[model samples]
Target: MASTRTTRLDRKQVIDTALRLLNEVGLEGLTLRAIAAELNVKAPALYWHFKDKQALLDEMATEMMRRMGWPSEDQSADWREVITAAMQGLRAHLLRYRDGARVYSGTHFTDTSYAGPMETFLARLTTQGFTPAAAVRGWHTAYSYTIGYLIEEQAMTGRTFDLTARAERLADHPLAAQAGEEMFGDYDAGFDRGLRAVVEGIGATLRAPGAPGKGRGEARA
Candidate 1:
């Protein structure tokens, strides 16, 4: 039988090893045996805590969430400021590990334990005068946009193509050329702009007259 401290240390070791593997080899290359090998433990020992690879991945995702500092309770800060901080934290966390966004996007965790950040988002939206349904939609829209943007950003990590040259080529198409220039000059600024746009657009829609009910119906129309 293992001592309590030994068991605790083993669990941390497994999770730490898994995170390293995630950064080094990505989600696809991560496995129970691989993690065990990395930690010099038997594969069955890892299974003692995590039932399977999916379980391990879920644990890893949970670990990632904790690292992101998702708000546990309402902050005294402004709604937009709090929500934006959470989103930016997620973006930074995803960028920390190779293909972190891809790993996160592929998994689904619907239980309350898995939705801390989203719960915070919904609460913020509601406090800002959005109805429940509107708040939910706003949360989804923000989450989708953030995840999609991060995935694209991660995918572009190793490209050798010249974005400026591409922009010059697209000069024949005026709008495309302008977009290319925007893309080439400070990509991080572009992401921040898009994030603000989505959040502000949701706020505007929620505030519009008869929007709580009417806007949702019209949006579906």
Candidate 2:
């Protein structure tokens, strides 16, 4: 039931406009009105496509997932490599936009097309003898780690990483002063280390006795 003016704008156009607004003003400031203004259309024009801001947000999240494209077919790679690539791909994709991870984390997509990437990756774990429950938990843990890391990474974008600044104010705080360098040095390396731990921990569970979907006595006693 779109008017002539509204009919001119397709759903994809509206979503693109909204994403541009999101980059300019961020998630907190991204309003339907703002998107409308960017599109040079009335807010009601957008209503023809999106019922509300949440709908718009959901599309945006789905669009980002789509934009990531399907995962590559690395036939020789093990489950760990595949899982690592998927997690790191998500983190990299989320970092592309301002407040990308936050926007992605907060919304639920109506698009089920994301299942292509998701199911394939989960199948990899399941093939390695992981129960559905264990696979889901492991996937969630890796995803949560990526989201949390990206949130912290995005939050630190504009801040200076000077340990000396901390040294001036927190000189009396011995532990903070001692660990400031460790805290700020090489976020990329820190993230990789954490990612390895997550992958390794998931693998450990697969090898642990009493883990679901394993042969009896398959692992250590």
Candidate 3:
């Protein structure tokens, strides 16, 4: 991998180098030592900015979110559009690098960059009258689904599911054989449909009888 710039290294520069190298070496190959070598500094230099490799990864994930450009108040359209667009952006960002989903899975960012976008997402829902608890659940639903789905998507990138081949061996099973179309459908469409379902379910909850029911039929209608 290419070594970093000769200028004084900072947190952002280090992470930029790490992500560049990530595209080349992948998640498994990303390490503090490797990053230091790229920056042409001793490994200990990284500790000044990041406590450890996980901390660095958190920043990397944060930077990726920043670049996705979180929604603004004016950017708000319908609630469903808000939720689906956020989910889709996250999924696309995670797919930008190899194993990015796995890399971002457990990392937490303690900085403003992550906070701003997250706040933007939750605020969009709250302004529509979603209760705090409901807003959180909606965020979790979409975020968790994006992360989990992308993890599998990244894993299955070069491999084939080929349920058809397995079905041939079990030819007696009619259901398995009949599922060929279902098994090999458009992945992007399937993911969008799943995200839409989650958003729709959250909307349903708001619309249930005796609920605050804000942004339900009103915005959707």
TM-score of each: 0.76, 0.85, 0.81
lDDT (C-alpha) at residue 121 in model 3: 71
lDDT of 1 by residue, 1-221 (tens): 53322343356678788898888887778888888767766677787788888777766777777677665575334555555676777888888988888777766542357565666677766665677898787777777888898888888777766767887888788788777657656658988898888877876775445533323224321
Clashes of each: 0, 0, 0
Predict model 2's lDDT versus the native: 0.79
The candidate maximizing TM-score is 2
lDDT of 3 at 142: 80
Ranking of candidates on TM-score, top first:
2, 3, 1
**Residue 65 of model 1: what lDDT?**
72
Full-model lDDT for every candidate: 0.71, 0.79, 0.77
Worst 10 contiguous positions by lDDT, candidate 3: 207-216
Clash count in backbone of candidate 1: 0
Residue 174 lDDT (model 3): 84
Candidate 2 error regions (>4 Å) = 1-7, 74-76, 206-221
TM-score for candidate 2 = 0.85
Ranking by lDDT: 2, 3, 1
**lDDT for each residue of candidate 3 in 131-178, tens digit (9 for 90 to 100):** 777888878878898898888778777777777676787699888776
